[model samples]
Target: MTAYIALAVVVVIVIWAVAIYNRLRTYKNQVENAFAQIDVQLKRRHDLIPNLVEVARGYMQHEAQTLEAVIRARSTAVSAADEARQSPGQAQAMGALMVAEQALVGQMGRLMALAEAYPTLKADARMQQLSEEITSTENRIGFARQAYNDQVLDFNNEASQFPDLIVARLAGFAHMEMLQSTQNEQERAIPQVKF
Candidate 1:
């Protein structure tokens, strides 16, 4: 009777171990997929920048410095994008992308502010088309980032939970990074122009 009881205990332990391990595997995969989606959107955004720069260059002939800054920001973003694609697990890569993104936001703000000086630039057909496409891409990036963060939360929760965390730890499950919520991403009321 004692032998039978020991065998039953071993069987139950094996089943529990396998179940938790499988769940951890699934959670890790989910996090990767989520990151991949964000990566794809960011790449699309990067591809659109050169076209935008080209269009903006024609009108901002005297603003060579501003154009160079935009180019540098775009280059940083592309580098970050490549790193993210090659190694999704590296948090530093994500940080680089955030830096790149913040730089981009600043450059974009500068360009738009400069646009105020050149109304004809905004009126150009190529510039208008690029602006519309970039705006759409920006919307997609925002949505994708939100979705990636949401999935990261879910995966991290599962990875940290009681039995799962044990399995996660054994299987090398690491915590995923949260999306950066910088001041640039926040909204402020535009100052009123009571002319």
Candidate 2:
């Protein structure tokens, strides 16, 4: 009878371990999936930058500093993504990437506003195409960022919960930061710009 009880206890422990293992794996997958969404958006932005620079060059020849900033920022942003190929575990590494990403976003915003300064560029066919691409890509980025944050939130909750947290700690569950958004999420509810 005692032998049977020991066997039953061992079986129960094994089953419990497996259940916890699977739950943690599911949460980790969610985080990876979220980052993948972010990757697609970032890649789109990277691909669009060259076209944008080419389109704006003719009309904005006099605006060399602005053009240079856009190129420099894009380069840095792309490099940063490469650096963060994995979800960053170190705080400083993450911070550096965030700074680069924000710089890119700011530079892109400035690029769009450049349309106001260069009337000729605004009217050019290539510039117009670039503008359309920027607008579409920006909308997609916003969507993907939102999705990533949502996933992060779900993962975070699981990592912090009662029973789940127990498993989470054992499974190497460290908190992942949500996309550090500038605007309040509620304000980005539309996620699109008309211009």
RMSD of each: 2.8, 4.2
| Candidate 1 TM-score, true structure as reference | 0.87
Per-residue lDDT tens digits for candidate 2, residues 1-195, read 999999999999788877876876786687677677777878888888888887787777777798799899889888887776566423454566678878887877777788677788788888788778867877877787787678777778877888778777887888877667633355459767788
Q: What is the lDDT of residue 55 in candidate 2?
A: 77
Report, for every candidate in turn, its global Cα lDDT versus the true structure. Answer: 0.79, 0.76
For candidate 2, list the clashing residue pairs, or say none.
Answer: none
List TM-scores for all candidates, in order.
Answer: 0.87, 0.84
Off by over 4 Å in 2: 88-94, 182-195
Candidate 2 residue-wise lDDT at 117:
78
lDDT of 1 by residue, 1-195 (tens): 999999999999889888988877776677678778877877777788788888888899999899889889988888887887775646887788788887886887788789769989989988888788878877877888887788778888888998888878887878777667422734445666996
Alpha-carbon lDDT of model 2: 0.76
